[model samples]
Target: MDKIIIIDFGGQYTHLIGRKVREKGVYSEIVPYDMKIEEIDSNVKGIILSGGPYHVSEDSPKIDPRILDLGIPILGICYGHQLIAYMSGGKVGPSKKKEYGITYVNIINNNDILKGLSKKEKVWMSHSDSVFSLPDDYEVLAYSENCPIAAFKHKYKPIYGVQWHPEVYHTENGDVIFENFISICNCNRDWKIENLLDKMIEEVRNEVKNGKAIIALSGGIDSSTAAMIAAKAIGNRLVAVFVDHGFMREGEVESIKNTFKELNLIVIEAKDRFLEKIKGVSDPELKRKLIGEEFIRVFEEIAEKVGAEYLIQGTIYPDRIESGLRHSDKIKSHHNVAGIPSKIKFKKIIEPLRDLYKDEVRKIALKLGLPKEIVYRQPFPGPGLAVRIIGEVTKEKLEIIRKADKIVREEIEKSKIREKLWQYFAVLTDTKTTGVKGDERAYGYVVAIRCVESREAMTARFANIPYKLLERISTRITNEIPQVVRVVYDITHKPPATIEWE
Candidate 1:
């Protein structure tokens, strides 16, 4: 396959870069930073350097200097940009003013890589150290207000560097930059995101041949897609288990049951069982761990009776990445990844869509002929409403959040803007406030509305919802949900705040 090789330096969004490339109809593979040159076979068309949490120095995670001599097209982002400048006899150090969030870059030279971008374009930047000066053979292509060398390219070779991230959705015309890079690589745009369906089903069939496999279906896009793939692969050997963990939104359980009627679904009303383990669990990590373990226990009992030897989950790459990326990209503990026990009773664990993102998974779901409700459902956390509440778990708090969430969803859907926003939901915060209700003083909980626009969950921008819509949501939330006295909308993005409150 003609592909681009993304060198992973433990950056949070290294997987995202690969996703962007694959979305552009070109195959992409990720390798560790220390991957040997021999592994860079003839099929490799280009190379990308990913950003990470480190300064450019000799002591940092070093890349092999030999790859530069290979003459393959190379594009470095943030740290990768600085590394290229430093390696090619340029200067790199802390910038006078660090760049973060949406930034504007002025194109000094319209080179081959910056082919489609305007003279001044908005780009996504999050970095401290920058390429202070380029090498003798390199020329600066663009510059921002703070960083002198925002974009650069070698004079003779097909090498380029950009301090901003084109992989992120916040960057204006980001995909155009990748499209230009693909043209430079001269790759055949033959890959389709939906076509991966056959390969996934075949892999599942090969992995779990002649054995019954039980899947933990959460009714979300990821699990539903995985379930469909599993069913086609193993035929009647697949069993879908839905565990009600006492933390779901209003009518979510009933809706899920109705959505998956074709499959042999087993509904386990373990609300009391899960709530017991979650009670008094004020800590977020502990809540996730408890719920995760109890889920495994429930599945094990069901698997034992069904004679199922393999366990399947809808665990995607973001779930694993947020749960600490298996090594050093620590963010938070996702129940599906970090909360899994060290030992399991199943013969093997299968995740057919493990390498995919939410949007990528949606493509596969559509290809499998899944319903639109299941395919386009807003991304939900595995830990459910437990993560939505900041403090300890209780039946009262769950009811409060559930009602508020429904109101938020209802208002958004009624405005005919649900499809525009990536996720629009409510969070019941731990704080309380005093307000006047019915001409009397009343103390009630605070509910926050979070709506963001994002392609991948790695980076996000607050959705520019109409003010009238926000007012309607606020009014309904406070009036219908009597416990909520104050309703505030959250405008923070993913870098500072995750979608979930916990």
Candidate 2:
């Protein structure tokens, strides 16, 4: 059972490297940076050093250099590249000018892993430090305009280093690079979704035992997949709780209901007096906290009614990191953690998908025979339209946003662009602009349409939407939603901006 070990150095795409290895039918696992290098023996055929936020010359944490001495095929990425250079008698320094986005790399030759790749290719680069010098035993493989040593390989060892991320979608031919590494290492092709399903079923059954399991069903891919898996493992003992917080899309409630009905699982539909409580809230964090606290209250009451002992929510890896729980800085508030009240009462909490990322969850969903629509649905935040809208939430605002979002969906579907995008919708803002409605001066809200294409929601780029399609959406939104006087499109990517407006 040959496998590849990925050492996590805190870069956002560390797990993505492991995913790429797994996609090539190879088994991979993320190990802590402090893990012993001697553990990489016998069955371990390859090693991948992941990128991180820390600079190599900084007085921060460092990994054991014995990892390079393990004598296996090693590939260092980004910070991994810097770590190898700094620890192996080389020099590293801050980049004179940071290469934060897309850049072109020139492959020096057609040898080693760069064999089939083109002489010139676009790769994503994000670093504040660069390797100033390479060791005497190493040879340069590729270089960019700014960073001279973009790729390198040692002469006597099977070790390689890449200054850019090969796992990111922005990098061209990234997957093929991993495939070559896996093939060259002769790693086993045993990691498949079917195998994972059997393992998860057994694990869930043992964890739940005879106790009941309660899953918070939000009609999204994460929770819906969690609910389905738990139901299969525990039968009727799995209780599904759906909370309607008055911020969902137009058809979310009925869509969730239909899903559970098809599965024939026991569902407890809980609807709060959403309009009464969140009618005029403005602050983003405050809005999340209020919704979270209110949701816990509803869950407590529903748990009492159903007599369940465990409260399960779909807490993904990114959600935990974004909530500042994992090895990541605080990015945003996940409703399950940031929004839920601290004083929780009744039933222990369980999260099956907590350790898995968004892409992994989709694989699990596909393995479990979930519908295509449900499996590929865009990642929607638990706060729903409440967070997407830029101001205080109200019935009128919700209605206007819902209709505008519906128009976006309809036009996208009609134009056949829905399949090409990851997520697309409309948002209402607090500011209003004056416009002419039937030759009369009228003041109404501003709506911004967001459409993006991404493999996973971790980082995304704006979708190159057709101008004619945008025209149709803009026209329909202004004509249908009287409260909306103008429509604008968001053309920003993820690094400088997040997916949502708030």
Candidate 3:
């Protein structure tokens, strides 16, 4: 398969670049910035240099010189553009005015990478350094108001660089840039979801090798899809274990049980157990750690009963990246990633979707004929509602949030924007506000509604929900849920605030 190699320079959206490539039906992989040139597969048809948080004027990691001579199409973004220019006998220096948000870039010359884009288009910019001079054989392809060299390319070779991030949603016609680059690479768009399903089944069968395996099914797309694939590989030998961690959405337990009725499933009603373990845990990371450790303990007991030698989790690339597994920085500790105890030496772990992103996983789920509800379900954190609650885990708080969240979901669905929004849910904060109910003074918990829109969860913008819908959601939550006296919409984006409150 013709694939693209993305060299990671610790950029937040490095994985997002790979996701966008895969969206074009071409496979792509992210490698460390310092990875040896020989380590890259010979079949890689193109290379993408991801933007990082480092400045090119300072001591930044150098790229392997052999990559330019490999005769493959290469594209650089933001910091990547500066690095490429600095490495190829060009000048790079700190920008007097750092471009951090949306900027307009005007095309000086239409290159293959900028093929269907307009003369001037909006692009996302996040950089402190700029390419002061072009390489000997390179010319400026585009320019912006603040930055002179917005884009550049080799005079003869198939090399390109852009001063903005085309992988993010804020950039207009971002997909056009990716499609143009893939066309330049002449890659075969043969990578399909059906092919992935067959490959995963075969790989799972070989890895299990007649050994029993248990899936930590959380009713999410990742775990559900993993369970379905594992079932196809081992049939009755695979057992799907759903542990009710007390922090799940309302009716989640029943919904999961009914969804996997055909599969060999065991429902462990350990809600009280989980709630007790996290009784006084107010710290978000500490809550995740406790839940993760407790989940393993429950799974271990069930694995022993089933005589399973392997543990399957629906851990995808985002989870691994957020958990600081790969070369990326730590955003948060996912239960499936950082939650797993080091003492879990009993069963070998299997994560089939580890390399896939959320959209990719949903494609596999749809290809496998999984239910629409499960396949198109919103992305839920593995730590469940525990992370949604800002303070200590308590029965009273959980009840309040669960009721409020249900109202938020129902109203969003009624607005016919549930599928359009990436994630829309309610959060219970520790704050208390005074209000009047039935002509009486009442102090109740404050509930926050966070809704964001994004193709991938890497970067997100607050969803522009209709004011009527927002008013409806707020009204329903405050009126129906007595404990929630106040409801506020979270307008913050992903940079300052994550999707989840915790």
Candidate 4:
């Protein structure tokens, strides 16, 4: 089997390269930047130098020169390009002009990797340094309008380098560029979602082996996909445990019940002990810990009755990556990942979708023929608006945010814009502005609507929502939800700020 090794340099999208490679039916793995060449097997056919937030001229920049001598095909992206130049006797220094966002590249020499792309192409570039001088052994295969060496190839070797990221959708012809690389490298595209499902079933069967499994069915994509997969694997031996936390979004409880019925899976709906657990806690982390502890307790009680020996969760790649489990940034704590109890004795944890991203999970969901309502649903935080609301988790705040979010969705649906955007939702901020209603001073929480356009959740840009749609959403939220006096639209992208405020 052909394999690729992605050397991680702490770039947020380092794992995305591995994901794309896997999607192409090639096995790939992510390793640390400082790992020596001796640690990796020589049988690996290729290496992908991932983009990172480092400058080659910076003190103590990472460089692994030994891999260059292995003669394996190498693809360098962004910072990787800079490092290659700096390490291969080329000079790298600060550029007078910074090429940050989307850049226009003029490919002078159309090489094998640029087969499907034309001479004038737009690629994603994010770097402040340029290769002042090229090494004697490398040739400048491609060049942009400003940058001389937008792409390079080592003399008499299969190593290639690109100054832009092809994994990101922002770059035009990214897919075509990847196809060229895959074809030239002879990577087999055998990793289908259906094949992954078959592999998961086999893994689950071996793990359970005539035993039973318990699942936390939260009606979300992850949980729902996990439940369906587990049921498919072990049939009636799978028992789904739904914890009605009372703080869930509208229609979630009924949604869970209806979905389970349609799937013909045994569901154990656990209600009435959730509210008692989080009585007066206001801190966000404390709230997550409380919910997680209570959830484990409920699962343990149910597992004892069902004799389940394994606990299955809808833990996706983003869940673990965001929770510091993978090569992703440390975002907020997901109840499924960071909220696990100190001592969990129910059974071994199994997650089939743990290595997949959000878009991949949606693809899997669609392949499984899940309901459109569930398949195309917006991304929801596992903590359930607790972190969305910057302050505490009061009933008043939850209701206000929920109504605001509903209005946003309704307006988008009415305007026929819901399908165009990736995710659009409302959040309740702790800031309260002064407003005059009926000649009275009103101080209440502010609601912010976030709409972003992105292919993968790794990077995103602000969505250009129409003003008419915003007007309708604002009007409905103010008229219907009295607690919220002001509604603000968030126009910030993902770099300067994250989707979630907390």
Candidate 5:
């Protein structure tokens, strides 16, 4: 299959670029910015330089010089655009005005990269530097109001650069830009989810080698899908352990148990044990570590009982990147990534979906015959409600947030824009507000509703939920849940605020 390799320069959208490429029916992988060209496989037909949070004037990361000499089509974005200009004997400097949001760019000339785009279109920009002057063989293709060189291309070579992010949804016709670039690379759209499932099953079988394996199934898409794939690989030798951490949403545990009954999973009802481990833990990171360590302990004990040699997890790429792996900065430590104990000596860890994004995992789940509810489940933090509660994590907070979150889900599912949203949940803020109920003063906790829409979790925008739906959710939560006095909606996007409060 034809593939595209995205060189990550610590940008938040590096993974999103790969996800977009995969969505186009082409395989793609993310590698570090300074990866050796020789390490790139022959199947890679194109290269993409991902945007980063660094300025080109500083000690920014660079691509391998050999990559330019390989005769492959290269598309640079934002920081990558400036990097390409700087490396090609061009001038790059700090912009007088930084473009951080939506901006209009006018096409100076209809080039291959912007073939199907309009004469003037809005694009998402997030950079502090601009290409002041092009190299000897490069010319401007498009120009924005603030930045003269919004898009550029080589005079003769198959190299293109864009100062805006086409992989982001804020950019109008972003997919069209990618499609034009893919056409320039002449790549074949042969990648399929079925093939990925078959390869994963075979890989699991080879890794286990006829030994028993245990999967930590949390009833989420990742864990459930991983469990199903593992079961397919080893049949009766694979055992699934579901640990109720006492932090799941309403009906989540029972729903998972009922759904996985056909797979013959072993349910471990250790809610109280998990609750006791995280008692009085107010710090979010500490709570995650405590939960992670406790999960390992529970899984280790189960491994001993089943004599399993491998412990399978549903860890995806975002978890590793957010956990400070690779060349990316640490956004937050996911429990599956940073929370795993160093003292795990009973079983070897195996993560089949480590390189996949959430959407990719969902595709695989559906392809593997999982139910629609399991496959299309909203993305949930591995730390559960511990992170949702901004301050202290207690049974009381969990219960309140669970009830409010259930109401939010129910109302959203009944709305016209339900399918348009990626994930929506209720957050129990640490503050309390005063309200009058039954002609008396009442001080109760405040709840914030977070709803975002995105193709991948790497970047998200607050969903434009209808006012009536929000009103219904807020009214239901405040009227039904006595602890919640005020219900507010969170309108911040991912860059300014994470989907989760913590």
Candidate 6:
């Protein structure tokens, strides 16, 4: 397969770049920044240098200087862009004014890579350094207000570099630029996630074999899909365990059990125990670590009872990425990945969907013919409402947030806009606000509503809900949930605020 090789330099969106390439029907493989030059084969049509949190100095990461001599088409992003310029004798320095998000640039040249894009392009940027002077044989292609050299290209070589990230959704005409690059690489569209179903199932069978396995089925799309795939591989040998840690939304456990009744579903009632464990933990990361460790201990107990030797989880790519990879910084600790303690009892753990993002997992879910409710279900954090309730984990706050989240879902569904949404829920904040109800002064917890639209869990933008709908939701939340004296909607995107407030 002709593939695009992305050299990861610990950028949070490194995997997102690969997912976008694969989204365009071309295979993309991510390798370390120090991957040997010889390891890159002729099948690799092009190379993309991913952005990272580097300032590009003596301590910055590097690729083989021979990479430029390989004559392969190269596209460098943020740090990659600076590296290309600095290596080839261009001057780079810290920016007097940094470009963080939603910046506009004017094109100076109509490069083939920027074809189909307008003269002025809106892009996402998070860079602290700027290329001050161009290298020999390199010319500026675009410039922004703060930086003179926002983009550049080789004079005689098919090499391009951009100071902004094109892989993110915030960039305008990102698809067009990717298509133009695909054309420049002279590649064909041959990659598809749906084509790998059989192979994935076979791998699951090989990993478990005859050993009984317990799956941490959270009833979300990721775990539900994994459960279906694993069940097909090992049949009744797969036990789907749904833990009701007393943090789930109202009636969620019953809805899940009824959905997967055909499978050997076991519901563990440990709500009180989880609340007790998470009590007084104010830090979100600490709460995740505690909940994650408790979940493992619960699974270990079940594993011992069933005599199972392996544990299966619905962990996906975003979960792993946010939890922090060795090369990348930790955004937050996912209960499944970073939250897992160092102690375990299972012989091995299996995550069938670890490599896939949410959208890709949903594609496989449809291929496996999972129920629509399960396939299109909104994403839920493994730590549940514990992450939604800020500051402390209390039964009262959980009840307020649970009812508010339920109201959010009901209103979105009632408005017939559920299908267009990725995930919609309510967050109970620690701060209390003053309100007047029936001429009575009341002070109570503030509830926040978060509804975002995103392809994968990596990047998200706030949904533009109708005003009447917002009015209706706010009215209902305050009216129904007396503890919520005030209701406010979250207008911030993912970079500024995550889906869950924690």
Q: What is the lDDT of residue 155 in candidate 2?
A: 86
Window of ten residues with lowest summed lDDT in model 1: 321-330
Ranking by TM-score: 6, 1, 5, 3, 2, 4
For candidate 5, lDDT tens digit of each residue in 1-502? Answer: 7899999988878888888888888988888887897898889899999887787864777888878878899999988888889889899998899888789999988769989888999889988889989877998999988898999999888999999999988898899989998999999998775578888999999999979999999889999889888989999998888888878888888888888787777888877898888887778878888888988889889898989988999999878877777666678878887999888955478899998888889888888888898888888887787789987677788889999989999999887798899999999999999998778899999999999998777778998888988899989998999988899999998765767777
Residue 439 CA displacement from its true place in model 1, Å: 2.1
Error of 1 at 310 (Å): 1.3
User: Measured by C-alpha RMSD in angstroms, how accurate is candidate 3?
Assistant: 2.0
Which digits, one per residue and each the tens of the lDDT, describe model 2 over residues 467-498? 99999899988888888898889999976577
Query: Model 4, range 211-272, lDDT digits (tens) per residue?
Result: 98998887878788887788889998998777766666777767778777755545444444
Evaluated at residue 125, the lDDT of candidate 6 is: 88
Runs of candidate 5 with Cα error greater than 4 angstroms are: none
Ranking by lDDT: 6, 1, 3, 5, 2, 4
TM-score of the candidate numbered 6?
0.97
Evaluate all candidate structures by whole-model CA lDDT and list the values in order: 0.88, 0.81, 0.87, 0.77, 0.87, 0.88
User: Residue 231 of model 5: what lDDT?
Assistant: 88
User: How many angstroms is residue 325 displaced in model 4 relative to the true structure, after the best TM-score fit?
Assistant: 2.8
Off by over 4 Å in 6: none
Model 2 misplaced stretches (Cα beyond 4 Å): 38-41, 262-281, 337-343, 357-360
Which lDDT tens digits does candidate 3 get at residues 283-397? Answer: 9988888899999899999988979889999999878877777555688888877988889945578999988888889888988889888888999999888899998989988
Can you tell me which runs of candidate 3 are displaced by over 4 Å?
57-59
Could you tell me which 10 consecutive residues in candidate 4 have the lowest summed lDDT?
263-272
Task: Tell me each candidate's RMSD, in Å, in order.
Answer: 1.6, 2.5, 2.0, 3.4, 2.0, 1.5
Quote the lDDT for 308 in model 2: 76
In angstroms, the error of model 6 at 187 is: 1.9
Better of 3 and 6 by lDDT: 6
Task: Give me candidate 5's TM-score against the actual structure.
Answer: 0.94
Of 2 and 5, the candidate ranking higher by lDDT: 5
Q: Which pairs clash in model 5?
A: none
